[model samples]
Target: MDDQQNDAAGQAATRHAADRVLDAGALRALAHPLRVRIYDILSQYGPQTASTLAEHLGESSGSTSYHLRALARHALIQECADRGSGRERWWERPVGGVSFTRPAGARTPSERSATQLVMSEFFRHRQDRLLDFVMHSEEAEEDDWSKGAMVSTATARLTPEQLEELSGRIMAIIDETVDRHRDQKGERVRPVSIRADLFPLATLEESS
Candidate 1:
């Protein structure tokens, strides 16, 4: 099968494979705004030291190190085998990426509460990232990346199952695109942050 056909055939199976589950502790650990920012930086920039992350985020190295250790304790990140020594440790996410949903095997309302915190942070980070691009994209666009930077919004009426399928398909398409350029030799290949927001309008907020 060609790449397109392969993606179509494996879409159902591959979507879940790319995302690992988070437990209550892990969810809570990542709910902080700074922790979320640190995770995003590491995921996008590859392995990073606490010092580098601190510099990028304008945080103190001590603060970054504390958060990095917390993320590691929950297995959200790990030490890089090929980089760093002594105090300048490096960190990266696991080979399998993580997804934000209800915690796996959560039994209590308290566990679900952690999920809420994580969900809140998720929305905050998503908005901040889009805002960053919008606020400063003029300088970046001069380098020929403007076409890829955009906010796409669409509304649709569908059942929850349909929404789930749509989410899977969107992620599958993204996976296919990333895998295509992941290993090939290229000069201008740059990281592109993509976000998808799909939901019905009627229930955008919780009922009182």
Candidate 2:
């Protein structure tokens, strides 16, 4: 399939084979805004040392190091044993989809708050990235990529069951494509973000 089609399909499939639903403790660990940012960086840019992450985040290495350790405590991230050494250990987000949905029986106020914080931070990060891309897409458009790059939105009405079935099929195609090219690397290969937002719109009465 083409890049645009593939990206649209992949984004539609938010849950995947690598998805991991967060438990209460993991949600709490990831609730902090700084930790969420750190996790996002690792997810997007691959492995990095505390120093590099701090530099990119405009925070002190010490501050980033503390958050990294906290994240590691809950296994949200882990050491890259093959890279870095000593105090400058490399850290990476384990390859998986982190589902922020609270686990069953985790309805305590604290757990709910944690889940909200993490989800908010996660969406904020995604929005910021998308905005950044929009601001810079003109530069990219000058190249061959413009043909496949697009920004689009649409609305539809569907029953709950239909939505579930549609999303499942989208994800199945995405999974097959991703599994085949998960490790692709070459001179022309670059990381691309796939984004699709499929959710119910608030009704007029609900908005009021």
Candidate 3:
């Protein structure tokens, strides 16, 4: 198959894989720095061979190959059909996106740690991107930028119940907006990421 066809197939496979909510173990598997970097590359550039990734990351092809296998085992990625060469295998992320959902009645320390690790990596990635964008803003056009770019951290006086209610409202707004654009079609309409993060900073007493 041609490269374009291969890329389209790989994207379809990845979107299909992302449709499922990952389990705790799967989240942990995806939390590794190398694995996350691999996903970021695939999301930006489509399917890639382990050798290509190794070259990009300055790591050995064997090491990249191993991490690719681990991601596949966790269902985060899958092997695409190899090009004409039998030795060069390509990999793609399975899902268009990943969401972490905690199971009810969770009590295990290991499970909690897994969740924390995934979240920490996610925030770290976000912070890095924000810093990069700010550092490069001189080269980016201001007219093309959205005014919704701002980061703020503050302590709010709210009970747990109030916080949950606020979170639900925020999620509803996000869902409504997403649903409105779900069927949009145009040359300008491409998949854009919208990340909304809401979490408690600390207990009321601890913050004070």
lDDT of each: 0.77, 0.80, 0.69
Badly placed stretches (over 4 Å) of model 3 are 1-19, 82-85, 102-107, 141-193, 199-206
Q: Tens-digit lDDT track for model 3 on 1-208?
A: 4565445545445443555666767867776788878877776566899999999999999999999998899778888855525788988865345666663333567666777766676668767877786787667546355344555556677778776555555555555565587557787565445555677676679999
RMSD (CA, angstroms), candidate 1: 3.9
- Single out the weakest 10-residue window by summed lDDT for candidate 3: 8-17
Clashes of each: 0, 0, 2
Q: Which candidate leads the pack in lDDT?
A: 2
For model 3, what is the error of residue 154's alpha carbon versus the real structure, in angstroms, after optimal superposition? 10
Please identify model 1 stretches exceeding 4 Å from their true place.
1-14, 102-106, 137-143, 159-162, 182-187, 203-208
How far does residue 80 in candidate 3 sit from its true spot (Å)? 2.1
**lDDT (C-alpha) at residue 39 in model 1:** 84
Task: Tell me the spans in candidate 2 whose CA falls farther than 4 Å from its real position.
Answer: 1-18, 102-106
In model 3, residue pairs whose N, Cα or C atoms come closer than 3 Å (at least 3 residues apart or on different chains), thus clashing, are 14-94, 18-95
> Top TM-score: which candidate number?
2
Q: Estimate each model's TM-score.
A: 0.78, 0.83, 0.61
Ranking by TM-score: 2, 1, 3
Local accuracy of candidate 1 as per-residue lDDT tens digits, 1-208:
3677546646745656757778678887987889988887777667888899989889899999999999999999999998889967989977666765655545777777777766777678778878888888787776567765667766778889777767767777777776776544558876677776776665546643
Of models 1 and 2, which has the larger TM-score? 2
